[model samples]
Target chain A: MAKREYSYYPGCSSQKGASSSNMMKSVATMCEELDVQLNEIPDWNCCSASIGYGSGGELPRLVMSARNIALSEEHNPDQDIVATCAACWLSTREAAERFEDDENMFKEANEALAEAGMKLTNKTPIRHMAEVLIEDIGYEEIGKGVKKPLEGVKIAGYVGCQTNRPFGIDGESYENPMYLDGLVDALGGDSIPTYEKKVQCCGGALAFSEPEKSQEMIKGIIEAAYDNDADMIATPCPLCQANVEIYQDQINAKYGTKFDMPVVYYSQLISVAYGRNANDAALNGQIIKARKLEEIAAK
Target chain B: MSTNTAMVEKYRNNFLKEVEANVEEGEWVKMCMQCGVCAGSCPLGNAWEHPPQEIFMMIRAGKREDVLTSDSMWMCTSCYNCIVRCPRELPITHIMHGLAHYAKRLGIQPKGNPTQWFSEVFWNNMMKKGRVNELKLGLSMYFKDGFVSGIKESLKNAKLGMNMQKTKRMAPMEFFGGHGVKNPGDLQKIIKKAQELEAARIEEHGK
Candidate 1:
């Protein structure tokens, strides 16, 4: 194997005070354990997440992602760009696809790149980290790498909206993405097999603007996890993890339900399983403390 | 002929024409068959004043006022649930977002749409620094309604803020700095170029 390497785009969410930095840290540890070299894409700008879509027009948003793609091609042309943030993955993939579909948009994006002395073919394969694990690091390899199996923890694999639609992992169903469940099983943990809200949207940044409505969506997702007997919820998207994890108390207060499921990045669980310490996986940032995780990892 | 022409003018087909031109994949909005799957699949579908399916209907009926004024455009989290489920493969998410930007540009956004305010605040933060400074963005958004609202919002989220701080993901010094990406000059240059290109395209299309 030509030692797996990737141009990582941690996205803006990975910055300080943001919930997704834990995810970024968790992914860094998981990558090390999996023998993956994550080379951060130098000067990678925002993927111009949905808020970008909501506020700006197509060309600006496309150019924002294009700059990152162009930078990746300039520096790491051979390696595919892997994004831990689902919105980043979706935004970059959508931009690449849009460029392919519209020559005019491509020309405009390139015009923006040219200002920075760069241009892109939109050829860089933008992939999610989860895709790297599921497709490249097979479940058996993942199982073999696990030092602690996380035997009793029951996780509801929440895929959220961006990863599995219009452009999901190759051949995965839009409505029901099974990659996360398989990942949980590989970790030797119990998965909520019939997790109904697996593909539900976590209201993304709406948790900022339309807090009530976003809370309703969050309520449904968390309640579903609890209803299915999940010890915690695991996800690939930082927005999903953050929204579900940080908002539980508010959701409980509003909905009159007692929900305490710890929402975590899948990488956190994998890192723990692979014998890394809590700090490496950035467990400190997790709002809902997972005593189960702490106990298991301590073993 | 006079009466019929007057009726056509009132229900301006130009409304649909304008949206189609403004939206990226707006032409596809014409393909919506009222399947209602979009409305059914949306996570915040209940919140939409007129859900995705009806927005399409409103577009066709030339109900320009209703379509632009609806909170549905502002409420789209871009979940893509509707796009994947649309029988015609309509990019419902994009259309909703397009309408939102269009609504803002036209100065017709619904009065009470906090989403509109928040997105603009978030967007402006990115535009200024070339990346989002979470604290700055939050401060801007909270203060957007006014100073009092800003304090209230901060107090409300104080616990969450404290938790983030304790984890060391965000530090007190971040209020002074430590959030933006390096080399903001380069980021701004790219943005300027993109805007110029976009402006030229609009001029070419004579829109």
Candidate 2:
């Protein structure tokens, strides 16, 4: 059988956010072991997520995402474009869907791509790395590679709004999705049960548009995790990581509550549990400021 | 001769009207039943003068100014508790957000709150770089917000953050790369959309 590979688009968040980049690095290592190749698409641009749409309408946003997709198409025919950023996944997935669904819109988008020396044919699927792992690779296979399991720790899995919302998967309601929880459970960690806010927006760019309000949203998530008695929170989106991590301290200060739990990328947790070095797994910059995991791993 | 309309129905405009023209999910607003479930589940409802349920009532009563000017808007955490628990699924959170934006535009600042420092620093960072630089942004927020006392405490743990940044344990700042819409035209294109939305909102409210 030919070696399986997918073109990876790191998107803005992964490129800029250290935690997100580390998660991608760990994911790349795991992918290597799993016989999966991640080809980084060159010259890819922004996904223009909620911020873009809120600021620039759908067409400009679609054109921006389509340009990135076009770059992926030039490199690979009929291969899915895997993304690590939730905003990228949402934007690219929406753009790909729109390009395929609307002929006129597709022509306009392709025309814009031509300016960037690219073209979109709707030939590839835009996928979140989490989707590729959970849906394509399967948790059982991932579990098989685990040299160290994350035992005795309670984890609150935050999927964020983009991954599960706008009704992406067929027959799966975004609100009550269990894909991340399944992966966490497969890794032998306790996936704490959570309700509605688990999938709410982490106030991504709203950190710019409305900072205090955004912090409030972050505080709410932290509070929920605390209420659930979770030791940490895990997520797949870089924006969510950045927002939740940055606001956690503020949240703690605002309410005079001690929420010193770590917020990590799901892949980082997996990489750590697989006996990877804490440095290798990028556990150092976690927002919640907990050293328990590192202490345990050191032992 | 008691005519039947819920208190929420009578006071609906308290919150709803403030959001009447601005809500992205307007369908949710009409479905609110004033069940108080939203306020009841709200984590910070105790801090608000008008909890989520009352805010919604105020909105529905066309009492837009009260909701917009009230400190209650700032107290909302945007946690979506009201949105989730409301049988009506009224976009309570959305309304609150819209009101906040509106209030900001009108210069209705929150009093004696450290959270305001976050807003100032965040926008200043974004306005300059067109994207957030976490390390600088965080420090700016802390310093500007008068959290200088917390700075030394936070710095004690700075080694971890610095190490992560150095060893690539965390995402690097260069990835965002100031690639924001730099061209004047592109920036305008982005700004115009927001302007249109704001204009439409104001027109709807007869402002």
Candidate 3:
């Protein structure tokens, strides 16, 4: 039996063939090594992400998360709901918080849920995968599994936007979240302490809509990592991973600079350090390959 | 009177009150003391015609049409920098979204706003299947401007797309109606009912 189990909510980006499916693969591999089992909530729909606020409105947005929560409660009763996606976790957690604080909103949400023959009792706790990794599976335990430590790999942990602000991981500063750095250290990699742009926004869903502005923002993040002499950037959010990694070509084209920064999930680092092969860690999925991590994993 | 005009008359031209009643965390807008912290904190502060601080003041000053029609609110990426640094504990991010949402509902949001267009496309894509078909969403965004520009965008991204396909990160098969929920119809009914309930609530507020 696994030491801990969670009802997982893999957001749209983590779906097979989606943008950050590599993130899903690495998280699964990491979880397996850590003895954590993540069971997907059956028939779970989209959490509407943050962009949904424009079209979803207040009640509909709440109801979207409510439906997912209701489903998670029914299928995986008594287990806490966990999401790897920062936006999904934030939306669902915010909904849970709203259901607790506002009676009328809760009643309205239940009414909407009634339309689908589901009801939200708001019994289960919503959590990010990082919280489980840090709080539940502590650094010492995780360190124990590191058969091939990421030696000499200087990582700048980029806790961008959603995961670092408003409702960040417990006991972590919004401006400078140290949990990612700690994870890097646990994997025997050098964590750059002066990574100033860690919490900066990667333009979120607006990256595609407004590429220039978003790329300018992405430039600042990549430059900060380079300034610190980092090997790669690790992040907790899939959108952050996608935005920071996939746009280097455009950024280089527009700005007349060479930037080939490897932005990856922290879970990938963990899996690689745990002696998992490159395929197991899904390193090939990277738009900007982390050659150093891949070399380490191959060994 | 048009609903927008009637809304103005109903609130007696008090945009802040109208916002508080209709917007999602709009009551918190009154809490802004014009410290300009939010304006300074915004990542895209220079890009906005009116940052959060100015937008808040506009609401207080009853610049209803200007506040509603301005494209500033749509620039928000919900990075939550303002919310975290806000001394008043105001939910500035939600309020910004609420303002955009309110403007869109009143049918007065700025035209040709890319964010607004993408938001609509995303919402519709997710609503149809209860899961977002990312391929369709990406194609829709590229083609939104026109056929010629869409071709340019597709060709530009062709290498990236091929790389993604090679890595198995993106499946071309997804273009033909990818994964969906067990009961997309039921999910649609839930959203429809929720929307109706939201409409009724807004109507109650209007009264």
Candidate 4:
């Protein structure tokens, strides 16, 4: 089979030693196994995130992403750009949308890009990894790759904000997306039927700025999963994983709540289920160790 | 634009008017109709000093001092929950960030908006390197206020940091050998050009 090639924009979060570096490795391995080729955008910069727009106006933020888009076109022409980071996905897609909606903005952004000796026609379709799995690679194919089906593990699919809203899966409900749940089911895990926190926000970058307030939000997301008897929490965004997983102990201490929730990425679960080792899934960063995932992988 | 002071202030509301005039995305706040979907859907709605709806009302009421000084402006996580749920399709997330930016520009940021401080540190790091080195960024954000506070905060997160290191999650070497892109000069040029263009655009409005 000729590998389906895509221009991959592994956001800053995937850099070495960053929180989701392991997720990057896992995505690479899973892609190889699934026969989907990821040609990374050469020397990609930060997406300027939501904060980018907040600090600078629409134009600078637009240029930041537009520069990347222009580079992707220059290097990987005709190939769709795929972002692994949720913030990267949102910012890039948001830029694309703005360019498409307004002709003046598109022309102005291009003029700004000309200063950098680049041009972007905004033709490339920016897609998240979750969307690729659902559309490009079918669930049945993913299920067949599962050497270790997560038979007994019950997962709460925490879609979070970035991946779910503004540009979520085409057919999925923004209020209550089920793509994660569907992926869980494909991996042979039981997904919680009414995970109320599935759509809840995990305070993303706020985990740093306002820890107390942000942890309260993280607490609700994890607690809801535990309350529903979920063994692990699966998410798409790196910030969501960092906020929800990294702060469990701190949150417990702060709020006097008994909680130990393991947060894993959707790709991590897929990587392990596809017969790759736990390390490939970057399972070590999981503060609340996923014993269930380990046991299944060991089998 | 009318130079009538009180009439313009009372009729248009200073806060909302400033937001509309200054913030590009903040123009959509006029679409908000006191509907509470943005507030109701937010995970930290109750925690906010002024939830989404109340913030809208406060702007319309011309509570400039209150709006800029409130913790509510700094508390938004940029989750887009409010944006996705707002029936009026008001871009609440952008407006919230815009308010924070406006407050920062006016030097009226509230006392303890650590997130706002964190965001500053993060943006500076990104601008310089075209990438974020977590370890360096973390230290700068926590310690940006002062070394004493940095030590206190680092001690608090020492265990988490240690565990992250052991797990190979935190990139330690990045602090010493930054992971900026190969062509840092090119990235810096792009950043500078964008910044210059943005400054020019703002000048067009500020005048």
Deviation of model 3 at A2, angstroms:
0.7
DockQ of 1: 0.61
In candidate 3, the residue pairs with backbone N, CA or C atoms under 3 Å apart (3 or more residues apart, or in different chains) clash, namely none
Ranking by lDDT: 3, 1, 4, 2
Error (Å) of candidate 2 at residue A50 is 1.3
Give candidate 4's TM-score: 0.93
Better of 2 and 4 by DockQ: 4
Q: Which tens-of-lDDT digit does each residue in A1-299 have in candidate 4?
A: 64688999998878777788877887887887788999899988898776664455567777789888998999999999999898999999888988998786788787777766778899999999888899988788889888888888999999889998777898899887888888899999999858999878777787777688788878888888978999999888888888888887798789899888888888888888888777777777676798888776666
Stretches of candidate 2 off by over 4 Å are A1-3, A16-19, A168-172, A194-197, A289-292, B1-207
Q: List the lowest-lDDT window of 10 residues for candidate 4 chain B.
A: B1-10
For model 2, what TM-score does chain A reach?
A: 0.91
Model 2 lDDT per residue over A109-185, tens place: 66555543455778887887877787788889988887777877788888876666543444445566677677788
Per-prediction DockQ:
0.61, 0.10, 0.85, 0.55
lDDT of 2 by residue, B48-89 (tens): 788866766666677656765677755554445566566766
Candidate ordering by DockQ (highest first): 3, 1, 4, 2
* Model 3 agreement with the true structure over B1-207: per-residue lDDT tens digits: 556766877898688999999999888888898898999999988888999989999999999888899999999998999999988988999999999998888889887899998888899999999998888888898899899999999999887788788878889999988988988999999999999999888877776
What's model 4's overall lDDT?
0.80
Model 3 chain B TM at 0.97
Worst 10 residues of 1 chain B by lDDT: B1-10
Better of 2 and 3 by TM-score: 3
Q: Could you tell which candidate, 1 or 4, scores higher by TM-score?
A: 1
